[model samples]
Target: MLLCFMGSIDRFRETVPLAELEREGRVQTSVDGRALALFHHEGEIRVVDNRCPHMGFPLSEGSVEDGVLTCHWHHARFELSCGDTFDPWADDVQTFPVEIRDGSVYVDPHPEPDEPPAEHWMRRLEDGLEQNLRLVVAKSAIGLADAGVSSDAVVERGVRFGSRYRESGWGPGLTILAAMRNVLPDLADDDRKRALYQGLVHVAGDCADAPPRFDQEPFDTEDVSFERLKAWFRENIKVRDADGAERVLRTAIANGADDAHLAEMLVAAATDHRYLNTGHTLDFVNKACEVLDHVGWDHGDAVLPSLIEGMATATRAEERSSWRQPVDLAAMVSETFADLDSLVESGAGTEWSPPASFTETLLSDDPEIVVAALEDAIREGASVEALAREVAFAAGTRVAQFATVNEFSDWNTVHHTFTYANAVHQLARRTGARELYRGVFDAAINVYLDRFLNTPPAPLPRPASSTETDLSVHLDELLDSFDVEGEVDEAGRRAAHYLDCGGDVSLLRERLAESLLREDAGFHTYQALEAGFTQAELRDSPEEVRTLLVAVARYLSAHFPTRREREQTFTIAARLHRGEKIHEEGQ
Candidate 1:
């Protein structure tokens, strides 16, 4: 043993005597709570952090041979002097400066400083995205969150990366990113990071299989007016010319069309064909606007262009016989369009609420009746958003009441309709464009198309059904129900009871996120949960919230307990973050 003192980067403190270290070939010691490993390889004494960067295994127990130190636990090898890991999964270990003076060894706890925390994490994020390493991305998310980096900054990186990388344009990954961003305020601190992590991880994965995006340049002249450009853009979308639409869109942005105008243009084209792409086109357009809100309209060049491909190529509902036949819901929606401007003008200056049975008529079996009721509401002073909101509320009941007897994929039928209606509701609130109101009509018709999903409507979780007063108990019951397959009705009952007992909405939201994130949830699941929170917030009644909550619960429960490979990967990331000894045996 030797008395030791440590100094800054320029100096080193004495550790064990060189003679004893030479005899043993290696030694471990603690200084300032850090486990330091001293290795006598060749003629020099080298020092490094004893803990493995991957899982906090004791590297002192690892083997050093020929200037390479390998952790036996996972066989991660690092350079003896610089501590660079040969394995990317195992991050570089911290190596300290070593000196020898007067037959004793000295070590400096600090090494040359690297980049700033935020910059380092951002760089790590880039690497993670590029490599599609889920664990690496998870660590980057955790690091960024710990460094107090706002999700806005993190999301900007993801959007730019995804846009530049995925040739297929905006996919579920970017939607998840934006949707998760929308719900962050409702999540707990840890769940917030998880949400960001899930978004980032999905982005990396979504881009992995696709080739890089090659954006086309703006048109040669910036002489196009907004109206002319909008016309050309919609025309291009109608013809399914993605390249032409991209060029026109790029022209619009270059000619100074801001996000609001850009969104209106998208909504107009999206509604032109009535529920395009089974509602994904509209839903995706809505998400694009959302992501742009936080990442900035300045990024419209990168973020907005990605949506052109989805828009121009989306499948129009008119192509489906189900929408065209048995009711011609498509034409019904189109007929209402002619009167939209006048109806919207008539409703001006009047705050509107749904007629008591308006949504019921929208949900009833008759498509004509549904269309007539919507038009009637507009005449009776129902605003575009008020109409869209009730339509979305009725759409929620489809999910809350969606029958288990239907084939499992039918959950998505009602799920798609609700999300589409909610997207319209979201857009309606953003701007009062008369053309955008077409989506309200399109979405209502979609809900009408999905009426059979409620054939044997699942019992609504009656609010007062549960007498349990403890919110935590209700939350626990909700989670436990998810552990079983098809506990859909039970899950809804639990959430309904939680609200009945006056559970905090935010806390309930956090619990929902926890449940969803705990499994291998899908893209639509994220959308439903986030959209449910937003839609529920607009309504003043507990009953409305219950309906939304039950809808989300059943939707989530129906898809619960996926292999959870994603959660397993996330758990590994969390353990590494906590410096837990993951490689230890006999726990």
Candidate 2:
């Protein structure tokens, strides 16, 4: 097929036979060296350049079915309505209009005029919005799935397959379904309304089809998908577009949507992800505080404490040098609360305190405080897991910075001490607190010595050795130095002697205890003694502890009689300084 530009509609009408061409199913034509395919269906005639947009395939040879002309070579379909290719990979085809008048059908060898019908324009807008809704729902569904919700669960929650109007104007149809509880009072209780709101929030940006780019952050220009669009919307929500902002706001308000709510939701979503960047988070916090002060939630007295607590949580997390920081959730929450407070302060209305216990418990730093707060928040309709995680994170940060075993032990004195203890243990492992950990392990072993007496402590794994030192001999020498025959608890006395000899007796004594308690105690006992002697020598004179530790670790591993015990011995020895308990039973 070809593009036959017959000058103008009038000139073309006079030249071509309008009636005879319509009677024929197809017509072959040419223009500009390109072949063309012309066909009539239901009184409407379409003329398209015959080449497939994806590849140079003949359209005349293709089949016309269901208002689509399909290429025979690649099955690329072009819609006769728009002359646009249906294949996602294909480009649009060139279409020309045909008019039938008198006895002739005239093919206007020119591009169709840009005169879109009113209905077509409306359909275009509606279709774009519908496509956006589908994209939102699909993205939200994936996010919910990731968050451990099944597809069946989402459906059960009343998220039917339909679109809903969101204040933000960018959410899925599911959001509209959720809002129906509010729109239709007799549908469900206020409790359902709240649930729906939360569900809508959960899925709001869950299925963003594109990734977002924050201010000043570089974005990949090529992958501008739905996610990117939402991101751009979020980043630019507060920015006033001189030409359209007023019109957009006026239109939304006229449609019964709250303009302020839309703006706030946009800000909330944008700020949520970027809140950790100090500059951005602080800005939101300050704005939230201002809102609170204006509304009465700031109550003067409540503001500082809230800000301090929130900032403290942020600062602690920051100080720990963690790769991923908390989302400054506390700050976000504080700002939100402050906003509510402002409403009351202005006498617009008294905002319901989000359950006094709820606020107190969530803002607390203590695990017990958090637990209590979580329980209260859960009862008061807050996300229990989310609040619990927030508290856990704050407590974890403090535990990571603990310098002494006493601090860790003290922190565990409260109820629900396991969480704190676990945190302490994790921090101990991370910090390479081998010596301090040895002390803790020794203390534990001492408490359970009788129970472990019959069972041999598992062997320590051997480490890769860089030196050829005979660690066994060195241990034997250290053991020989101990006056096991003395009246004193010889083990303790020996440990003191090792200490005096400049050994890291703290770790050595723990290792010795572990070795004695386990079945493969012989080799580990020997290595522990050797390590102790080496440590002693290094401390008392001009030797390096790294050399000794590395050498002893390797030697014990090499000489181990059993491969099973070898790795055990080396690992235990390597982590001797780390606070992991030496398991008496083998895995």
Candidate 3:
């Protein structure tokens, strides 16, 4: 036994006798509430925090060989002396000063202030983003967020890093940030934190492996007018010349072009090719604007350039008329465009709500009637808000009516129509830009054109009378029987039953959303399901709500087929390892 004495403050305190630790290779002791592992390696004493930084596993149980300490759980290795981890996922652990005092081991518990907590964590965030280390990224995000760092700072940093590191420019990660940005406002407090973390993760991962980007020099003109810049931007985007477009945008920004002008230019380019890229290019551009709002306009230099790249690289769905069969969509859409101005002017001061028949008019296979009815409603004094809501619902119906037989990629077809319409609806409500209404008109035209693509057409349940079934129980049954054939019809009927019984549509919607979230559905499912709910929320009519819910039920039931159940192989292996009968007692 060793008699140890406490030293002055800031001095190392004897933790354990070296002779006691000689029997084992290491010893775990606490000094001032800090746990540390003291190791006897090659006659030299080394000390480090006992907790593995990876998952808080006690490092005292870890193996030390060849100057490396290895965690038994995940095989994370660290240099015993420096405490640097070889695994990026497991962050470097803190090492303490070791002192030998009278055959006893002493450890200094106080950590040296190598850097400020905020700065150190900020650097870790960069490393996590660069390496695509999920746990490290999450920890850094949470730590930074808890330290009162704004997500704006994190986003600005990510935008700078991503733009500089990826030579090819914005990729899916940028798009992902753009995509997730819209959901932040709708998320709860905790979920908002998660959303921020996810957005940063994508931006970081996108730039991780790529080389630095060399931005094109701004056109050497000091006085490029907003109009001329706008003209050039539209032209370059139209021709799919990303370099030309980026220069025009950058030059415009440098010459004092306001974000409003930049927005108009992007919108002009987006609408130039009606429903471009099934509306995703436009949606992405809109999301980019949202990113600007979160991160501040200073990042526009890098962020907007990526948007230009998206515009240049997008595959415009409007260019292809292959899906316009059974109807002359080109002619129908053109006629509707001619009447848009007169319709808006006439409907400017009118007080009207969309008739119950608007859904039927929308669902009708005739593009001409649909367009004409929409214009008539607007001319008859239907508010832009009402019109927006109507068209938005029709777009959701297109998604809901889409059949799964259209192949995996075909989901985009309806998704484009729905998202495009939803974006226009949202923009109209926000800015009341008449041009955005035209987007709605274009979406409607496309929706009408896509009516036939629903091949087996969505099965809308036509229950004779709404039954008195508990909506919650019905939803549960719908989920339970999702794998069985004809379940889509049952789902529709259940939806109808709930609507008839005067159920809380929002509750039912929440259930549906929860089911999708739990099932690990794809992106398109989320887009479609969410669009339908948004449309439903905008409407004032119960009948319209019923129709929307039925469509949602049908869409989800059709797309989300039964996942085959399987036993866990690890469980089977464990059973076999226990000495249980191998191979079912026979065979």
Best by TM-score: 1
Q: Residue-wise lDDT of candidate 3 within 1-587, one digit each (tens)?
A: 33345653546777898898777889998888777898989878889888777766678889999999999878899999899999877888789888777888877788675677678778888887788765666667666766778777776776677667777666556655544454444454444445455556667767766777778778898876787888888899889998998898889878876666667777777776667766777766665666687788777887777677667878765566643555556556666677778877887666887787887788777767887887888788876556777787776766656665666566577667777777677655655555565676777776776676676776555654546655667667767755565466677777777677677776677666544433334445555565667667777777667778777777676666634111122223223223233333352
Instruction: Give the alpha carbon lDDT tens digit for every residue of 1-587 in model 2.
Output: 33345563253533346555566677767744446788776667788877664444667777887898888876888898678777644445778766665766555566544543333323332332334332223223333433454333443332211212222221222322222222222222322222232333333333234332111222324334433433444344334231232223223323333323333322333233322222222322332233232333312222211122122222221223221233333443334344433322343322223443442243243333433333343334333123322333222222222222232223222111213222222223222221222212111111121112112311222222325344444345334433222211222333333433455434553343222222232322232323223233323322223223322322223222232342233343323213233432462
lDDT of 2: 0.35
- Give the clash count for each candidate: 0, 49, 0
Looking at model 1, the pairs that clash are: none
Decide which is better by TM-score, 1 or 2: 1
Which 10-residue window in model 3 sums to the lowest lDDT?
A: 564-573
TM per prediction: 0.95, 0.23, 0.78
Candidate lDDT scores, in order, read 0.85, 0.35, 0.69
Once fitted onto the true fold, the runs of candidate 1 whose alpha carbons sit more than 4 angstroms away are 1-11, 345-351, 465-468
